[model samples]
Target: MDATKRPLRIPPQFATYAQKHELFELYRRLIARLLMEKPEDPLTFMLEELKREDDDVPAIVIQGPPASGKTTIGKMVSAKLRTAHITPQILLEDDVSPLAAKGRAIIDKNQSIPMELWVQLIQARLKLFDCIKKGWVMEGFPENREQGLALQQVGISPKHFVILDAPDTVLIERQMGKRVDPQTGDVYHTTFDYPSNSEVEKRLVEPPEGCTEAEMTQRLVLYHRHIDGLRRCYHKFTKVINADQPKADVFSQVITALSSKHRSLAPHIPRIVLLGPTGCGKSVQAALLANKYDVISVSSGQLVKEAIANESKTGEAIKPYVNRDMPVPDNLVLKLIEDRLSQIDCVTRGWVLRGFPRTREQAENLDTAGYEPNRVFYLDVPNDSVYERLTLRMTDPVTGIIYHTLYNPPHSNQIKERCQRHPEDSDDAVQKRLAAYNAYVEELSDYYQTGLHINADQDPHTVFEFVESMLVSQLPTNLDRD
Candidate 1:
């Protein structure tokens, strides 16, 4: 195993287990048989086994040195077992790359990943496990004994652990053969694994100015330390597999090891939707709920905005209403909502509908279109209070900062002061706007039969507290509390 690869370490006690190879082969055969017996129902046997024993879903940890093909093997095993693949490196790369691009000091100079990031990734995987029938294959995670113990505390225990081992000479050969483009940092080997051959050669160069041989050696040492720690902690579940063999042979060994640890669980993940009116803190609430539940927040407003900008039929119909002072037709709004709900994210994590289905026609259309909210929150602010709130709202042209005159005024008070002088609109126009909003609220109440009425007259913090309490009462038990 290339010690440079950071993943879970194998337990030391397992090093003395004389039948490690035999056990791995036996499990692989068992998994293959189970898959063949009920190919159409891969999870059926596992589910039955779990039900009989009242056991939790087993987590499998794949440990190996860098460039030992850990990810490839993990993916193959996960696919064969019909399980989700959770790779912390991939997750962190996706999350932190943008931050790095923005010049944020998030990751260390040596690209050391943070512990909280790993925790969040594990939490996300745990949430996904609730939705999936098969378990998960975690790759590039538990870099040390501490992280492994943290996962164990959260009810995640490795039913089977596989550690790939190769001689240092083999690892050095693989690492030296590694050709990385200095400009793009695109990694390539002796094969057509990357781009053009000429480009790969041109890109291959010595490490950057600061990356001396000693620094590289230290990184490799740290990786070994992590692996050694893992070996000491998870001895019972650890299995050492020789990774110097052919790719096919190595994969066969991995398959055998995973089969014996298979167990099934029911897929009872709830498809929840959060519904509320505009300016009722729906977006903010959705964000909070998404953080708490580890689900994606699919905003209908953002979808409609994109559609409108793209000038789709639904967008064209709403143009006059949005640009002019007219109200959007019910059909156009309904179509926009329908388009949003059809998105893959909405289907998976569910959605929180904000500024949609304001009228009775649109509400009925939602039912006709088969889009339903598990919970609807009616932010019940007094009509006068709402009018006061809307009138005071102002946006800074330069900074895009929103401010309210009455509650949360800007530092200068210049905008509110200027508005007082103009006293812009006629009373009739304001009345008409309020009337339209009231009618929409009434229609919403009637549409969602079990809508929770929250007193929005209180301060925003208090209102949020009330909303949180209501969410706790209505949300699924599996969801985390904010």
Candidate 2:
């Protein structure tokens, strides 16, 4: 049977779009008539067309943050086009034992295939030229500039690059909520929007020991490199979909882009998440992380505030506790966290978790509930320093900006009236608060032994340097000393 000249089978659902264009309308009517009167003949004609040389199956590339539904979308798109879904990860995994036997260090301790493994996998996949003649949807390959170039060297160029853009806040929240099956590596997230079978909970896997901030950053850097390559080479053939929007809306935009005949450019979308503590300059640090990472910050406190304003059940439960300087119930806090994480934009990128897990019990709840941190940073400010800093705290009534009267006073002291008034009995209250804070720190120090501690009394830039140093030290290297 001929492969290239096969008769087209336009689904009934797409009949409307086909009717809107003259060329498509004629083709659609002809196909519909043939299907009704001469089904055998139409199949035979399509087989002939399949054999013809002019028809080429379209190629679509889907890219997005981890757990952003890229794989699911890839599968759906491939099914719609009646093409093979080729994921490089699958290819590499199939060949891992053989590749490793040949001295190819293909697998990391995380059991993920390395870059070289991808190169080998791509080379092997490309050998199936005849099989891919009908085209295939390639997912999870060309992870960086080098890999992309490698694919180009092997004469494989995708027709379109579909970039799924989502906010990092969404990504982080999603990631924190994500659970993978240890046995089969199936990924699942807890959400009403993406419901999973109750049995899926049994498959949750624990992350490997020593999964540190440095390790997470290394993976991110690799992702960045690959994304950069996609932007550089396929910039013209790119279609960016904001995955932060409603799933249906995002899918519609994707379908529209894929059905279009010509390639079009899409805007670059950034995802960011901010993480820090209360009154330890987490907000300021979040801004720094946002600027450095080129993504937006998702503030947990802000989310809680919004929830409280909306009088969400969980928020309402937390309101009295927070107002009375008491910790909310673990289940209530978890509900709040879960709700915030389910938002489309929160789990897409790096994010900060501010004003969360203030107590050891809360932190333990986070771990038990499966919200692990790639890194935990402690701002090690002395009690005296914190006292001095809080003593001068002031708020701008108009802009809601926080200022320090000692170091960052308002212009000409015009807003001095807005300075936070210390309690007449503040001396005792401050001492009590300091004692509680110290106790919390002592427990935190014990809990996260590997946590990076930055001196908060220093200049902000200097503290950032310490952060960068910690990150650099965490990179994958054979050096014994960290």
Top candidate (lDDT):
1
**Candidate 2 lDDT, tens digit per residue, 2-37?**
775654332222322322343453455345445534
Give candidate 2 regions above 4 Å deviation. Answer: 1-278, 294-300, 323-325, 396-403, 417-430, 472-474, 479-482
- Model 1 C-alpha lDDT per residue in residues 215-276, reported as the tens digit of each score: 44565677787888888788876888998887689988776665454332212122334443
Model 1 weakest lDDT span, ten residues long: 473-482
lDDT of each: 0.62, 0.60
